[model samples]
Structures are given as structure tokens and as C-alpha cells.
Target: DWVNLEAHELNIPKDESTKNEAHWNCTLKNRTVKVLRRWLNERATYDKYQDRDELWLTKKATPYSSKSCNYLLTRLIEEGDVPIPEHKEITWYSIRHGVATHWANHVGPHHAKEQLRHKSVTTTMKYLHSDSEMRSTAVEQIW
Candidate 1:
């Protein structure tokens, strides 16, 4: 998978009943192997990260709670002067949604579902709205 579970220290379920069902294998291209290696190396250089077992460590050397990554990204957006078109606020989820939407348009929705790890294509289908231009072209073809 693009995001290798092997690289991240996962919290394995202790309940034996659930353990077998907890994990799914996905594949990423070999192209990311070097990028993954670089991220791991970068993570190692942080202060106070020595005792941390989590995959993503905060700059303060603490383990990332759910909000911390978002907080960091928000800070980066402000610091980097990233222009938000239409004054739209951005979130990680928005990025993920955008990727899934575009991917579904480029590839079929099934591939997008795999990328997003959606159990059902219905979940991915939400992102697959047809563009007006595409709709217009379809109408022309029918005429």
C-alpha cells in the first residue's frame, strides 16, 4: 500500500476475536519507498522522540493526538501564506476528499474506493460528482 502499515507501529488489537479482522493489506507503488525512508529518518531526528512508540511525533517530541496533526497543518497554512481560493478553509479531510473525487473522475470509482479504503463504493461515490462541462458534452453526444 502507499501507506505501509509495516513502517508505522500499529496498536494491535489485544482481543483475539477482533485481531484477524483488524488489518487489511493494500499496495503502494515502489516509488514511495524512498519517500517513506526519508520521512522515517526525519522523524528520528526530533528531540524527545526517543521514547515515543507512535509513528508521527510532534515537533515538541510528543506523540500525535488526533488534533495535533491538523493543528500543525493549520499553522503551516498560515506560515506558508497558502492562498485559499474563494476564502475556503482547508482541512486534511478536504484534501482527501479532493483526491478521491479527482481520482474517481480519472479512473473508475472502484479504483478510487481502493485508494480511500472504502469498504463500499457508495462511500467513494459521494465524491464523484460530474462536472458541468462533462455533462454538457454528454448532452451534445446524445443530440
Candidate 2:
């Protein structure tokens, strides 16, 4: 829980809708932990619901729903002056897919599957995609 503040990991509670039947622990990157700690400190100064397990809250003092979270991400992307391609839209799941693709390409599908916490590697393969560089390298090696 956010209230406990573990040094290097965050506990994710299970959600049946997402197929997560048991709680899982995600180890954080060093930079992520630092950033989260700083945010928690700042959040503590203003958030009235300090006793709540949620790490984030809305202006109305409620936990953010997934839709609201995505809206906030879009707003942040816009406010940060990030450009979006003509026919593409970025959402939270797309960002996750990008990460999964990166891991699958650079590390391996098995490692990517473990990182994604998927019960089966088949599901992880859906996010794995071959980029131009990888395709070029494969052709070179085959020739």
C-alpha cells in the first residue's frame, strides 16, 4: 500500500476483471522509487485522504478511475508539448505495449512475459512486434 511505502517495490492488488487473481509485487527501478518518494512527500502535504491506500487522488478527493487516469495522461502529454502522429493516439495500454515490445526485442519473449506478469507467453506475443531494424538484421543473418 502507498501508506506503507516500501523502499524498492510496490504491491499491486489483484483485480478479477484484469485476470489478476492474486496480489503481486513489482520491483521498482531506482529512479522510479526516487520519483515516487518525492511525489508521495508532495502529495502528503495536500491530500486529505492520507489514510487511503491509493497513491493518487483527484481534485474531488476520490481515487482516479482508469478512464480518468488515461485522461490525465493525455492532458499531461499535451501540456508537455509532445507531438502525436497524424493518425495515431497514445493511451496507457499503448505505452505498456511499447514497453513490452522493447523487452521482447531486447531481452527475449520469456523475459518479457515474466515482466508483464502474464500467465502464458502466448498473451505476451501479442505485444511483441518486429521493427525495421530487427527485420533487416534477420535478413542479413540469413543471407
Question: lDDT per residue, candidate 2, 8-120, as tens digits?
Answer: 87766676225676766666878888888898888778747677766778988887887888899899989999989988888877888988899899889888887788888
Best by lDDT: 2
- Candidate 1: tens digits of C-alpha lDDT, residues 17-119: 2324445444444555666668778978876666665656666667776478678778899999988788777876677788887788778789898766677
Question: Clash pairs of candidate 2?
Answer: none
TM match of model 2 to true structure = 0.81
The alpha-carbon RMSD values of the candidates against the true structure, listed in the order shown, are 5.0, 2.6
Top candidate when judged by TM-score against the true structure = 2
Q: Which stretches of candidate 1 lie over 4 Å from their true place?
A: 1-22, 29-31, 42-47, 129-143
